[model samples]
Target chain A: MRVAAVVKRIAKQFKRDRRSLALMMIAPLFVLTLVWLVLDGDDYEPKMGYSEMPQPVIELLDEETQHLEQYKKEEAIDLMKDGELDAFISIEGMTPTTLLEGSEPSVNSAVMRVIQESLKSLKTNTQIEEPTINYLYGSGDMNLFDRVGPVLIGFFVFFFVFILGGISFLRERTQGTLAKLLSTPIKRWELVTGYVAGFGLFTIIQSVVIVAFSIYVLDMYMVGNFVELLVVTILLAITALSLATLLSSFAKNEFQIMQFIPIVIIPQVFFAGIFNLETLDRWIQILSQFMPLTYGAEALQQMMIKGAHIYDVWFEIMILFGFALVFFILNIRVLKKHRSL
Target chain B: MSFINVKHVSHAFGKEKVLEDINLTIEEGKIFGLLGPSGAGKTTLVNMMVGILSPDQGEITIDSTKVPSFDLMNITGYMAQSDALYQELSAKENLEFMGSIYGLKKSELKERIQHVMKTVNLLPHLDKPVEQYSGGMKRRLSLAAALLHQPKLLILDEPTVGIDPVLRKEIWEEFRELQQQGITIIVTTHVMDEADKCDELGLLRDGQLMAKGSPGELKEQHHASSIEEVFLTVGGVES
Candidate 1:
């Protein structure tokens, strides 16, 4: 009943702030939708200049990127130097060398992707030896969104839940109600548990809406059990909710809560399996173990992409629960600053 | 005999002692006021008395029993410096919540809610969310909530802050009326006029208790015309 009172009160408070409700429910879906569009772009048109081209090679280029007329090698080199061109193709003899004036890594990868895909498709049509395609979770058609969707799902649930839960608890300090609650008979852990249970209820709904939207509307990959996806998402929510309230003790206001996003949340983005962690420095990779999102990401990908059963990813579930437990305990300890009891 | 006892209570946050060598006793059925300015540690002392905060080097006993107990919590009502009402909820909902937490049943809860609302004169705006209420109205609602359980002891931290003078008087009258019914009200205030109204007052400055007595007794002792001058003289805080 006491927890109910806490739940009812927080729900009532959240109900009044339409902006927060919208941010929790709709913002995740909106971002996923944008990712769906940008990453799912079927054909990536890359700008290319030809230095010298064989008739067969010139025909191999896609209409979208083929600039085949006068194969002026010097002029093409100058354009690349001035950043006017993404890359240039030169066929001195039989083997073709791609001279790319690449500055940005992502742009370089993107250009490489388009050129390779076009070249392979063209080679297949010409009855030449075609490049072999092998996929683990997705085929060649799978875009970056599908690849990163698990991490994104884990990220958003962790992010919005953190911000919302942090700000809501922070408002208690801002609004002066936390001191009032401390004066009550409610024990410190009861306050922490009641908060976890209360916000946990709201987060369940937010997770459901956001996850369902990402899967159905954005059509992000989900090869695992729907129930497992829900499990990972809800666990991520618990971590977010607990970590937010715990860190909130250190923050004086909402802006300070936002400050945690970069220091606490953003680092997880790189380590949450959105990119290849193997390529990163070993120490940077170890930092992922500390982030709550890392476990959530691993669990989500295991379920959604690998189709691993609940038992297979049970360790991840336990780690996520551990993060939540530690955060919850820290939350109780932080209250000592307000009241020793 | 003392109804509430604090002995050699010293507290600090790290190196900075917020309350030091504090010894006090409160008589039963009395209107006791702790008067101190902001940062004078009035809140720190009250928190210890309520058992929310424990003294680092001492103890608090309420009604001859060691404090920070569930038994004490049920018997004592606390209204903190902050309003502590759920602003998204109606005043009535907030009262119901506070009442329920204190273990009040439905019939008694309803009766007490109405009585306290009327006591604080928030009965008219009982259904409106606290966010819509003015500052004074919110203060009144908080007072109403603190009165819901009919606890024998009531501890209020800055209870009349942000309250209009007219409504503050009415609330003080209610405190007196409750005191007549044998409720011990421990109120903290920085206002001189409010301090003068208490049956007994303690003047605190810089975490030290300067003096404690009935208003007239302190004034007579200090040979001062007003409680403020008596306080200033005792605290050595003239100006």
Candidate 2:
């Protein structure tokens, strides 16, 4: 009953502060929209610069997917360095040599695809074998966004809740409401529980909106049940909110709370299965176990990318729950600094 | 027995001793002022008595119960230097939030909120958000919140700091009325006039209590014409 008051008050405050409410929901949507536009834009067209190319091979290349231009060898290299050209092909004595600007992995792949397509038309007389492609999880139709969408969903929910919850808790200290609270008969655990329950309520709507947007609106992969996805999302949000409140005690103000994002949260994203951790040094790869987002991202990928059921991802769910518990206990313990009671 | 007792209490932040072997006793049903200049540890001492901070050495007891006790917190209403209000919340919501924490029932909470807002002359502004309140109005609103729980012991840390002389007088009058109804008020202030208004004053300087007595008695003992002169003489002798 006592906890209900704090929850109700926080909900009321959120209602009055429309800007923060919008930020919680809209910021993730805005980022998702940008990602959608960038990756789902028209297929990449390679700008192929040529010093001297056979007329037939050039004519065979699709006009829409390849931008063909003639240049001197030196000029081609210069244009490639300046990023105006994806690749340059120069033929000497029926041998084709292609120079590619390999700085961007996606662009390099696009350039190679175009080069292979153009060479296929000319190689009808020769015996050229094509390599077969196979996938363990996703088919060839999957886009880059489809592969990364689950992790991005986990990351956005974690990032926004961590920042907003941390700043609000820090404000409680800087504004002296913490002192006033400690002066009352309210136990330390009660305050911690109140904060988690309050922010937890708001995060319910937040997770639902974000998950629905990603699955239904943006057409990101959702191979698992929607209810299972929500369960993981809400637990992840609880972990984020609890961890933020625990860390807020170490900060003196809102800016200090924000400083945690780059140092604390950003590193989690890097280690949370977003990047390939197998190639990392052994000790560095082990660091992922300590980040709450690591477990969240792993479970989300299992559900969204691999089409794994709840039973398959149960271990990750347990770890996320464990993290939320530890952070919640730490938050209550940290409140002892304000009042021993 | 004294309602509140401090025996050989001392506290320090890191290596700096903010309070040293502080000993005090506050009788029930009286306005006891901790009069000191800024940074003289008035707020620190009040905070310790209210169980917000535990003394490093010695003990404090309220009504014979050791302080820093969760149960003791029930009877204490503390108003810190800052308003400590949720600026986004209306005055009524702020009052209701605090009232609920004290475990006041719905009817009692509503009545107390009305009575306290009326006491602070904030009844009209109860529906307005605290961020829209002026400095003095915020101070008054904080006082109303402190009083909402109907605490038996009210510990106010510089409650009248930003209030005008006229409103300050009115708040002191309210304190007097609360005392008549058997509430013990411990008000801390650097203002000399507010200190003189307290029934008894503890003159503090540099974390030490230089003297404790009624305003008239302290002035007569120091042979000073005003409370400011009395404070200077007492604080000067101790330091």
Off by over 4 Å in 1: A47-52, A62-67, A74-136, B236-239
For model 1 the local lDDT of residue A109 reads 78
Ten-residue region with minimum lDDT total, candidate 2 chain A = A57-66
The chain A TM-scores for the candidates, taken one by one, are 0.87, 0.90
Q: Write the per-residue lDDT of candidate 1 for residues B110-137, one digit (tens) a residue.
A: 9999899999888889899888999888
* Tens-digit lDDT string for candidate 2 (A1-341): 56777777788889888999998999999998798877766678888887667777687554635578888889988988888888888897879888888898988888788777787777678766777888778777778788778888999999999989998998898899989989988888888888889999889999999999998899996677888988998999999999998899999888889889898898998888878799998987888888888889999989987888788999999999999999999998888877877
TM-score for each of the candidates: 0.91, 0.94
DockQ of each: 0.60, 0.81
Model 2 Cα lDDT, one tens digit per residue, B168-193:
88888999999999999999988887
Best by TM-score: 2
Q: What docking grade does candidate 2 earn? A: high
Clashing pairs in 2: none
How many clashing pairs per prediction, in order?
0, 0
Clashing pairs in 1: none
In model 1, what is the error at residue B181, expressed in angstroms? 1.3
